[model samples]
Target: MKKLVNCFIGLTIGLFSWTGALSQISIEEFAINFSQPVDIANAGDGSNRLFIVEKVGRIQVLDEDGQKGEQPFLDISSKVDSDASEEGLLGLVFHPEYQQNGYFFVYYTATVNSIRDAVIERYSVSADSSLAEHSSGVEVMRINQPQSNHNGGDMAFGPEGNLYIGVGDGGSGNDPGERSQNLTLPLGKMLRINVDNLPYSIPANNPYAQMGGDTVREIWAVGLRNPWRFSFDDNYDLWIGDVGQSAREEINFISASENVGGLNYGWDCREGDIACPGCGNNQCDEQTFTDPVHWYGPGPGLSVTGGYVMRGEFYNVFEGHYIFAEFARDQIRTLQLSPGRSVAITATIPANNISSFGEDEKGRVYAANLSGIIYRVVEAGILPVELIAVHIKKENKKVFLDWETGFEFNASHFEVERSLGQESFKQVGIVPSKGDAGEITNYQFIDQVYRPGDYSYRLKSMDLDGSYTYSMNLTIKIENNEDMLVLPNPALDKIRVGLPVMQEAGHLQIVGLDGAILHRIAVSPGDEDAIEIDVKEFRRGLVLVQFIGEGNISFTKKLMLY
Candidate 1:
């Protein structure tokens, strides 16, 4: 079995306390059992689904909950060339208007008549919305491959909706054909094309789009050995993970805002910052090409697996970090770029065989390995409470709050916080925790003096080392002896109900418009003021949330699920 590590905030603080302790990030398994997964992408649709590209010519779907679908969304194994380990289905991207056009594209290696070639094709989703129609595929472009090892099968859509394809120099030990620097060949260059047209059209802004002679109009940038993976950040800046020939693995970057192109990235001339040994100084002119933004010696890793910049809210600490990994090292690392364009490794994750890095619709990052598992990246030391739920309720003249935790590691206490209206929460009360325990622990607090109005409450879980994380905010309305608040009206996956402090017990029911009761939850005096209910499994539409408290105090609200 593969070794799995689950580090809950406070439990592994010491393990990540490095030079920049606060900058480190951690990982937890998200999904497993994939066959040679090479890439991951989202449809850009509101469905919040993830598409995993397996190198064996299939695309698997993972729902928002990280559960793999029973059937693949797309499969084209018959046309894929899997004879070479590096050849097969390699890249996938959904059109910017995928939600409307249902168009998606994939890059793969195809074998025909004992020769292998790289192909890019577009496909549309099936009428069922869950599966892709293989028959809907239309060939977009195809390039003859001289050798299979360095096919450079990765494609991504730029901010302008143009497709950028990475092609390796005709594969061999070195650029024997000098194809990278040759403006006439598409090999070893980033190609840009407008795929909205039949057979694709060259982007007008491409470096050689209008150049006459033997110049290939699709060339964008040149001199890349094997750019295995690359991505565009929110700013449309391109980042490339170019596999090294002998000494260094490099990450090349280009800002889209520059608008300048036709630049050469030293490959045959230079492996990284140094000259390629035995290649001579024929084209090894440092001033002639752009050097990589970052590069590493061939010890800790071999090939570079470029990842996305952290734009997700789940890991706030890594907000602007550029995450990347190595194939041989099996390590996930982050880079922080200084204002001067210098880069530094801020964190490292001890993983194995990380083949690719992916993001969900919400921007949460995930890593996939050759071992058939994917892990979600999270901030290492935070959320010490591990709270299962936190709620609040209001009675005749008093308000009560309750919370439960599945486990606590070095937890010292809980600070009951309150805020009037939308103001910041203030410390109102403190409840000592059960110290450090692995079993379930429940706690509660009460406020006897409070005016009738709107109030919000949250729990501040504190650790012995002064670290803390806050729970989800729970709000309540104190009106004429009644209190209830159904939150996150437009819910994506789950909904929460805030109950009033009660003298006895009550029952809460969620009913659909068709007069069908979907759930019935019991509420008691010491129960949490707020209760979370998973509504993702429910149909998307309007639903009634009803709560009947002691003394027949009832309240209802309409919820919209999407």
Candidate 2:
């Protein structure tokens, strides 16, 4: 009956796009008919066929283009004892080297004599691309559970060729058994193991193995309550969204290269830096267990939904952003991370009972709803904002104006305008759009040959119906001055700087490619002979060098640091 009600709700909200209030994000519902789809995975083989995991122990196929396939790829519902509610099929993973191995693994509650145990079983598809129930599964590993609730379920292959698994705090709120904090137990922790060798092999570099302690050798990072889902970015950064008890929901990020062995995420010790009554101050070590970079409490949702980092080139704002969801309230939020260990919310998408987020071969993300609908997050582009960029070059005075349809709307053309000072303006040109780009779109117009001195440009992206909106004016100045230069474009260790002679001190700032300011210093050619900027701590990316010298002169240069 509950499933029937959920199906009805999904059918009711099936026809429209879910747009949240904060940012210009649009969602399209696809693969609507399913029985409690919990997670989805792409084959990455250009087949466009997506494997959707049903929590009730089944794998359905969605066509590469996101159309619902007529049949399921695999179903082990009879083998699973889901009487315990959380016991059915929880996670599924395809071997990264699957083309050669033809291997797959599933995490589920296998029932034997009415006793349900958390098990990871490996299965291979038949030559016909179907699974058989003739007991063709090999039990890779199994952990006996006293209770059923917190079966931290989700698995993914990391860049280092390791399979990572998430385990819960062994059920019942507040971690009654304290299993998450106990390194000896696998519960309430994330485990990483190498499956290249038959069943599974423990990696030599696994933090616990080298540390020589009571920690579980397969444990990657510990102290997680119940991480429903976690995935690695293209660069292998691990983003884990762990479910909170009562007060918080968190998103944890760890750099792949930085080996933080036995990193405790303060589950019972702390939830997002707030102490729980059960965890005392004296018990909490001053070692500063890494708290979540950002977290929120249940305001609109019951549980926190984990998502993936968008590395696809199709969208700009979504790139490098971690898109997450709230299960109870159906809100999709984006966390923008900075090099300096800071994060900000760029946008939040609207959703309902969003159980999991999946990625396809093209790197676009998909959100699975318990309401029986699956939605893919595509770059609908920002609503057409009237804006222009002015570039001044010798013999080529150019003005670039960009506009597009805003969220949930369609835009058509853009009218460009030019201003001499800040007041008097004249019509420049009219750029026509390719019609309504249902999603956010980026359009540009260039105007050549303009008068000297400072110039400003504005634009209005109009709708096909004659309604329009204005854009922020862009300003540019035509000038030539080689005031500063950063040697060794791909800089390392120490970077040399050459500054033009100035009367007073100048301010120097190093901004990352993401517009994050990393280093700032005041330097004056008259005061200091030269400045050597340190590039050791910098990661591989494009950087901006800003120099503000005497006479308030500002110079910007892009530096590539490896």
Candidate 3:
């Protein structure tokens, strides 16, 4: 039901206007109608379709032209535990022989006997070719999670056809247990195992393979603090975006040409080339650990979302550019590592939570916003704000309109347009934008109805350059008097309900989804303009605001509180 309305707003907004060597990078919505997408991958079965993994335990299929299928390819929402935003159906990968074996794998967090476990499981596709056989799931690995915050939930098959899993240091501030450097557990390491065997097998070349001291044989590389996302280039070179604790964000790169195992990436003691403080006083020598190839601190981002190296149709100058994003600041960057780590900041994409970045079969990169929109990363462009949602509601002789934004670039203002029935739309109100990049902004407008007819409304998001895009139309029919207007919906703390001009008294009841009343207030409407309902104590999510008036209850409307 949260599917976005703007699909064709910026179909060609500077997506192909720049081809310079150092062109700025931007993004456009590639697919819509996803619910909290955290990761995306392509099944290499020659279909070229992208499979998006949602935090609610569903994997959906989207075709090349941004078209998505109505049905999900896989659904295991019942098996996954996503109570914690950090945990969910996080990663997906197809078997090298997916065309024949119909096999694929997923990584998620689930509760077993009251303990959360990071689980890796495999499944085969159903006969329908688009759905997975529910009964064909097989558990490959399950590691007990120490906390919910830092489950490094991403996976990929190395160039050697083995599964490589990224895990976090047993989650707490500063790795209290010092698990990343511990070899006895898999908590904070890059684990490589052979999935061809049931329940998985340890690769012989792993660091601990020859050791007999109870060291984990699944450990390939050690000392990583939440390797949230990582990928490999054609040469099997690894690029890691390690999320920092408090100081800085760092990227770990391991060239396959090095041909070595048991590489240690410093954590707990070091963060982003600087000695970490408040880390339980742990110390390390400069020779004991490898530092990041590139690092940056706060304003840009501390929650780094790793990305891929472009290998297919890309900007003319970025043949080997490694593109990544900062989840904290909603910014993307391109890096060159030939001579040394050289980084360039890309444009800031909105809906700030950039959970993950993925590449399609053609090597076109895309970014996934946890707020439910996937965007295609392209060369320099003006990324405009898409009116993702527009809600229209009526209360006594008046219609209220409100909507939310996802991306904004050089945004000027918004013009609210209204139409009567099939008539042409005319501008009714102009709302100035907050103009803050990387922030979620909301706008509202109201139109009065004198006669009974259907009314439609849309928004014209105007850019600084004078280019404008129209959002999908929202229509509502008027049968009676429609006046209690609610402003700042999807609100945070409070909302003002515009009461009827003549009405003086009523009872306001806040109802939850379970049909239970959460708050009750008596309104003494008089000289006041509107009734201010304090919803700061109510839980975040959907709630019904009902007005109990003279003879019958005036209106029951749904208000979203985030």
Best by lDDT: 1
lDDT of 3 by residue, 1-562 (tens): 1122222212222332221222344566677668999998988888888899999999999988878887999999999999987888989988888898999999999987889899989999999888899999999999888998789978888867888999998797888888888889898898998887686888788778888776888999888899989999878989999999878788888888763678888887788788775576344665377789888874333698898887766654456778787886655667777755555443233334688889888788888987677977766434356555678999866789988875566788988888765466788789987664544567888776544568778778777877565564577887633545666688899887755544446787889999999988876645343567889999999998888876554877789999
CA-lDDT, candidates in order: 0.79, 0.71, 0.77
Lowest summed lDDT across 10 adjacent residues in model 2 is found at 1-10
Compute each candidate's TM-score over C-alphas: 0.66, 0.63, 0.69
> Sort by lDDT, best first: what order?
1, 3, 2
* lDDT measured at residue 550 in model 2 versus the true structure, 0 to 100: 65
For 1-562, candidate 2 gives per-residue lDDT tens digits of 0011000001112233333322344455566778888888876555666788888888888886567656677878888767775667888888887767767888987768756578998877667654423356888888776578878779999867889999887887777777877778888888889888775888887878665567678887878888988998887888889888777888888888764667889887887657754543345666457788888874333688788998867556567888888877656777789999899887654456788889888887888887577877755433433222223333333445454433334557767777654345577788877564334445666665323457666665566666454443456764422466576678877776656556677789999877788999988654432367898898877889888766767788888888
Error of 2 at 560 (Å): 82
Which pairs of residues collide in candidate 1? 391-529, 391-530, 392-529, 392-530, 393-501, 394-500, 394-501
Report RMSD for candidate 1.
Answer: 18.3
Q: In candidate 2, how many Å is residue 30 off?
A: 1.9
Higher lDDT: candidate 2 or 3?
3
- Distance (Å) between predicted and true CA of 267, model 1? 1.1
lDDT, residue 109, model 3: 93
The clash number for model 1 is 7
Model 1, residue 481: distance off in Å is 74
Model 1 stretches astray by more than 4 angstroms: 1-23, 284-287, 299-301, 382-562
Assess the local accuracy of residue 57 in candidate 3 as a C-alpha lDDT between 0 and 100.
96
Worst 10 residues of 1 by lDDT: 1-10
Which prediction has the highest TM-score against the true structure? 3
